[model samples]
Target: MPRANEPGRTVSSRLWDLLFAFDPNNTELTLADLVRRTGMPHATARRLTLELVEAGALERTSDNRFAIGLPLWRLGTLAPRAETLRRAAQPFVEDLYTALRQHVQLAVLQGDQAVIIERLSAVNAVGLTSQIGGQLPLHCSGVGKVLLSHSTPAFIDDVLAGRLRRFTPRTIVDPAELRGQLASCRSTGTVVVKEELSEGAESVATRIVDGRGKVVAALSVVVAAGSIKLQAAVPSLVASGLGLSRSLGWRPGIPIRTS
Candidate 1:
């Protein structure tokens, strides 16, 4: 709840407030919205917002609203967590997309959510709400299930105990049922989700590991719900996941069924 003009806050702190004001839900903001959210004086907020724009950190849209700019996006890509995994998995993502002509995505576990790092899609792939840097729910999404399967037991218990949102009728809300699914996913290294995240999308996801055999990320191929493509896509999805894992120094000898 702190703002730029607080008695002891620095200019850098103020700048960060402006930067953090934008998120997935609040992608664009007017000058008034910025002032209110950052709790800065009108003139001060306008001044800082304009400075961010000039510095290529914020962009002005056609409607005169502001959004995170391209330069900020470029800088964010340098973040160690996303950069390392993305750089290693991008090629395999593209190859999977090429072979299946579906949408291929790479995601990493972030807190209770799965954050998508890279996505490759064909011109006519099934519509997806997720984009690069966007988040997917852990309970019902393909990548989400894979990442959740590898998370700590306590974390999984906390997640299942919380209010699980239902995106569709197919979304599994029973903790016992979901626990069973998670167990199967952890054992098989792959899962098939049917319209759990969206109405018409199905995702086949698998785990990606590092040399240490630690699960580092998840990869998925998304296609139309009930597409005949599921079976064909599974092998390639698993291979691509394994290939990217090996690139990170993971060995085939390491079993994926580990807790």
Candidate 2:
């Protein structure tokens, strides 16, 4: 049965509904889950899902659940912003990973969340709650804090007034404490977070800016909590971030020195 008083939706809207049903927390879905999420009639839901599967927009798992397919992922890489940023940032990200031998990540702010655009993983790195295409919180993540430091005051206020999930005990929840942290990050252009998002993980991150001084991205290195000193990693992470920013036309201090 169609949902009670469900707004009349077009085919394009329905397609968007099905495609967007897959998110960070809901990556794979059973038919019932899709039907429930989309609130479509069972027959219409199954038909559209099958169409998506046949069109290679989505794939069926071994357990008969559906997930975003390789074809869609390939298509997503062609998006101008994501692909270009991935290309421009890969070398710096690689250098950071090689220097630190830990999990290195590149992220960009998408609305209030930091979207992981790319990552380099080490075999024995600490366990992570996030992966490529995953979202990070604005309060507790190093990259998230860096991005938040540059965000508009309105955005920061809105996020602070909403839910601030505490993944670990160190996660920043107090708005006043977080305000001070943001101020410090804005001044230093970097943040070192200790197990704020995930237990057993720590990160040091800095901002990547463009010619206009607009922070376009964030770079970070994730290492095991207490395995090595955060100070040891901060220099390299900051240098790599500045190098990447310079490549994108950000000049730190002094006026327009040869870009």
Regions of candidate 1 where Cα sits further than 4 Å from its true position: 1-17, 23-28, 36-41, 50-56, 59-65, 69-71, 255-259
Each model's lDDT: 0.89, 0.85
For model 2, the stretches where C-alpha displacement exceeds 4 angstroms are: 1-5, 23-33, 51-56, 59-67, 253-259
Each prediction's RMSD to truth: 3.1, 3.7
How does model 2 score by TM-score? Answer: 0.86
The top-ranked prediction according to lDDT is 1
TM-score for each of the candidates: 0.86, 0.86
* Candidate 1 residue pairs in clash (backbone atoms < 3 Å): none
| Residue lDDT tens for model 1, 187-216 | 888899998878888889999998888888
Question: How many collisions per candidate?
Answer: 0, 0
Q: Give the Å error, residue 104, model 2.
A: 0.8
